[model samples]
Target: MRYTLRQIEYFIATAETGSITLASERVNISQPSISTAIAHLEQELDTQLFVRRHAQGLTLTPAGKALLVEAKRLVEHAQQLYEVASEANDKIRGQLTLGCMVTLAPMIMPELSHAFTSAFPSTKVMQVVGDHDTLLQKLASAEIDVAITYDLHVPEGFDFVPLASLPPHVLVGEIHPFARLSAVTVKDIASEPLLLLDLPISREYFLAIFMQEGLTPHIAARSPHQDILRTMVANGYGYTLANVRPRSDTAMDGRKVVRVRLAGDHRPMVIGLVSPKERRKSRLIELFENHCRNRISDAYIPGMVAPVMEKRIRLD
Candidate 1:
């Protein structure tokens, strides 16, 4: 039973996208090629890997699930080997795939990209934006080198380092009553219609605000797209809860959205850099990680902000 690394790569891609067509598009290969590779992999392993449906996408069988863990390990080992060989030649020229949440991507990526590029001109960086779960899956599979996101449930066998602490702020349409308030409290927000950022960790974090106040919020809508949520709040559809405050210059266009500090003791969101603990680090990954850490430390002053909530909020 000889399964090639290319087969594993295609399988992981299909697993991530859930559609052979989409996966092929992502990897820039033909759908028939991907399908053939998957079929060949199943034959070599002597198990049916995926259960296909007519309308829906494929789901991994038990055999597929078991093989995924080994596949990721194999891929990571191969990546580490490639990195070592590249460094042996005294060149840092290679791909650096990074994962980030939608919120942080817009604010921090510009500076990060510029600084990293200036320092390591040879390395090519690729950014993938997704929620926590999606990013973690990619990280585990060696598809992405690192992840930048809010510190949520840190899985076993992963290392995390804090980057910045963001304080929770209230976002309201200009016409909303709370927009006139100097500062608002969790209790005050309980009765208002709220548009929650529906990212995995964010949904839990925002809803936990209500739990802390011992009340359930009047949730208006939940979505993963930041733009959609922002537009919803800006158009007077509902208010939103966010840790990162909107920059004053970009706060409002014609939509008339205003950001206000939350009253009382609030939970600070700690965004961090995460990578697999068991995997051996390359010089490139180490250099990029250190640069990010230094930039974050210089940007955020700890005494100015409180610590994040220690309790984990379960959305599921």
Candidate 2:
């Protein structure tokens, strides 16, 4: 071969970090060595890999971007070689890539991922957060091995393993008119100004609450951030709907909010694991999937709280 895996490794690090200096720091190598490997790669491939700016970081050319996915896969496959040897001793040791929904990441990822790694010290998890559509796209493109997400717009070729049921709840300020209520129906809040959680499938699910009741939500504002929406609700900008509420009802800005059950019947979001149906499950993937099963359920989620309800969807 004209090039070495060391060259590919340096190439991927620089491409991801966007600078030879940062890539060297990440890989614990000298910046000059990193630069030399990438330069040699460019020579061997006869392509300009990155557009280098004097002060600014490097940006991948189209060719570099196209090859990045393959480079990452190659690294993952290389890691799998260790797993093969590890299997002789019945050890689960390899890296697993997880793509999580942005909103869910803060609520669940830290405890879930950390605990899994803690359980298997030799194993590691790398997470990338995005919206519903983005996570699904990454799953399709082989960028992520598994997705910890809500069941939303899941395409035909993906498998969703339901983990927990998050029923809808309403957020209101401590002084808001709805705070004293035990529960409120869709029609009761349908006319109230809504601070919508504006995300791809999330918004659709929230709006569907009103739609199923044959009413229109009076949307006053929209935000992609959950905390922002909570803060807005705390300050009485408007009420918002959510499935996951942090254990504490206080916003980051030190404002208190209340989570009131969205009363009566409506569709709730099911949080679960998603993966390509056709893909063969790797051992690391299996370990992570099993970890999720133990850590996430209607009875408990790692770092988030759900409203108490009599009925819940159980994993069978």
Among these predicted structures, which one has the highest lDDT?
2
Please provide, for model 1 over 27-112, each residue's C-alpha lDDT reduced to its tens digit, 9 standing for 90 to 100.
77999999999999988878998999969999888888888878877877786776887788876655577888777787677778
lDDT of each model, Cα atoms only? 0.78, 0.86
The window of 10 residues in a row where model 2 has the poorest summed lDDT is 307-316
Q: Clashing residue pairs in candidate 1, if any?
A: none
Output the number of the TM-score-best candidate: 2
TM-score of each: 0.74, 0.86
Instruction: RMSD for all candidates, in order, please.
Output: 7.0, 4.2
Instruction: Evaluate model 1: give its lDDT.
Output: 0.78
